[model samples]
Target chain A: MKLREIKEILNAEVIVGEDKLDIEVKTAFGADLMSDVLAFAKAGSMLLTGLTNTQVVRIANVLDIAAIILVRGKKPPAEAIALAKDVHIPILTTKYILFETAGRLFAKGIVGCLEKVEAGSERI
Target chain B: MKLREVKDILEASVVVGEEKLDMEVSTAFGADLMSDVLAFAKAGSILLTGLTNAQIIKTAADRSIAAIIIVRGKEPSTEAIEMARELQIPILSTKYILFETAGILYSKGIVGCLKKVDGDFYK
Candidate 1:
């Protein structure tokens, strides 16, 4: 889905990257632990997170992740917004919780990124 | 630099992704805290970390990071290695600590990912 579609679905307010809303997103990952996001988020995927800190934008920039949707109606601080704007990372705010937001997106065909690893196959 | 060059420079042991030794790396980031690595690691860059866990490999896989080098001679568990191999993330080990490893890489022209944010013009 596109960032605009995601925004409409979530009823979100775009805090940055308005010009880049046309970007395409194939998958979505939601997590509060930055570590988990870094370990599992696929490139071009959208991140739905509640952790409103500067690190989130930094992580997004490094991974080339599409955008960030802050759940629970949380507004990130000035520092976070400024950093995000500088990097052109779209930051959105949503009133729904992470699980709810993810459910809605999944129902809309926005899939998650977990690959099915074989039960005991040890090869890469 | 290529992962082969990195292994040579760090005198690292390749635990996985040996077939990917030819991969190119443009940047390097060293951190033990997974959050810090997530926040700063550029894609296709090498990560020098002392923390050995499935989470480290997971983070590198998520960000498309090129490889992970465990510093301080730390060895990851079987699960971590298995996970990294599944993701095709090269895992290397070095006896040097994080600081020493970073210095060697920087001297060898490996740059970090800190951009210059303006001087408190805090907009």
Candidate 2:
């Protein structure tokens, strides 16, 4: 889905990057732990989590994730937002709890990263 | 600097979760482009960048970074903030441009990620 659609689906507030709401997103990964997101998320995935901190942005930058969805009505500090703005990563906020948000997005056809390895890969 | 000190140094505004400002930060990596941050940043480092998007948060989470610093006076969107809050990663902002921000921090003794191979490792 496009980021604009994600906003509508989750009833999220946009804090910055209003100019890029229409950016395309192909997949989603939901997790609060940074290590899990790094080890499991596929490239070009969108992250859904409840953790709010600067490290989250750094993780996204390293993993090449497409976007982040903040659940349970949390708001990042100004520094976090500024970092996201600097890196051109789009951030989203939703009032729904993490489970509810994930369910809603899942119902809308967003799939999570799978355990399957790619065609040319022999291991996960 | 500790996250609290970083906040004071940059004279930035805090949007939420004041409970974590004093977190310690040992190193920082600055970039606006997500691709570069991912390719070059060291593990356990803090990210400094100008891009405000969800992907930046995702990158940080993946890299095990301690914090993020927004340079050139940018603000992350609410969605971005929410994501960061969920991850418990501290973020900071400064009005200085990328070069100036990096220089100031470097002058204060923060070093970049260096290419070092371990002595015990085999090539």
Candidate 3:
């Protein structure tokens, strides 16, 4: 789905990168543990978390995530926003809880990050 | 520096885990691009970036970063907040631009992520 559609469905507010709302996002990941996110998240996936810290933004930069959704009515600080702006990432904030938000988005057909495993003969 | 102290300096708003504000952060990495943050950030370090997306949270989870700071006066979506809340990760935001923010924090002695090299040990 397009980043704009996810924003509209969740009734979220855009804090940065408003110009890139039309960006497409195919995969979604939900986690609060920065460690786990780094280990499992695919490159160019959507991140859903309540953790609002500068580390999170840095993590996104490493993984090449398409957008970030702050769930459960939480808002990041101005510093976080400024960093996100510099990176050209679109930040969205919504009021729905974590599970519900994930469920709603999943219901809309957003898939998890795809893992590419090696096979004996051919790539899967 | 302690997360709480960082919060105070940046005048940031904590999104969750108020009790963990006293957590110590020794290093900080600044970037707007998620790709670079993931490439160079050290484990248990603070992240400063402008990109806001679920992927950012996922990257932090993987790297085991101490905290996240969103610069330039931006906020994340509810989905993102809920995920961070579940992970017990503390989120903070500030109004300082990328360069200025890094400068202030650096002036306070917060260093960048550590650099580790991988090579033959006994060559």
Candidate 4:
């Protein structure tokens, strides 16, 4: 689905890369843990998360993510916003909580990047 | 829904609270961030998260959450398991990632504790 449709569906506000709403994203990964994103997230998929740290933008850049969707009405810190702008990554903020955010997108045909999670989780 | 049904649907294993699998929970909150779980999560709701630590048990206890659904096949620290056993709160470990866990639960009529998010989000 195009980022434009996701925006409308979630009532999300584009905090960055407003011009890139036309970008199409077929998969999504949701997590508040940055480590999980680094480990399991695939390239070009949208990241749905509650984390607003600058590292989020940096990681998205490293992974070639399509966009960052912030749930539970979260807004980025100024430094994170600056970093995202510098990297040209799109960021959208939505009022839905994490569960609803994932459910809404999944209901619209957006799927998780990985169908099956890896066998085990490491200590943080 | 009953905790037994949830465990079956998510293919979750009972890490704690085996005797309480019949506990009924009607709502859920998904997050990996503990702060959000503390702030927005309601009492008696199931918490779906990718975090597994002693702090998770403490937070769930403070919030009176009905259960902890640990996603991504994450295992809690030994300290956390002990705490949950002491607190008598159920913990279910699922292999599904956070997104699929929430989507599946939401699809099954387990709704988010907070229906409409509050106007502004804090940093």
Backbone collision tally, model 3? 90
C-alpha lDDT of residue A119 in model 2: 41
Query: lDDT: which candidate is best?
Result: 4
lDDT of each: 0.74, 0.67, 0.69, 0.89
Runs of candidate 2 exceeding 4 Å displacement: A115-124, B1-123
Clashing pairs in 1: A38-B59, A39-B58, A39-B59
First chain of candidate 1, TM-score: 0.90
Interface RMSD of each: 17.5, 19.4, 18.5, 1.2
Model 1 stretches with alpha carbons more than 4 Å out: A115-124, B1-123
How much is the lDDT of residue A1 in candidate 2? Answer: 84
For candidate 1, write residues B44-86 as lDDT tens digits.
8777776788988999899888899886567888989999988
Assess candidate 1 and give its TM-score to the true structure: 0.48
CAPRI category for model 3: incorrect
> Can you write out model 3's per-residue Cα lDDT over B1-123, one digit (the tens) per residue?
899998988777787668899899877765545654565566898887655666787788688988888765557667767877877677787755443455456557676563221222114
Q: Residue A33: error of model 2 in Å?
A: 0.5
Q: Native contacts recovered by candidate 2, as a share?
A: 0.00
Q: Rank the candidates by lDDT, best first.
A: 4, 1, 3, 2
Quality class of the docking in candidate 1, CAPRI style = incorrect
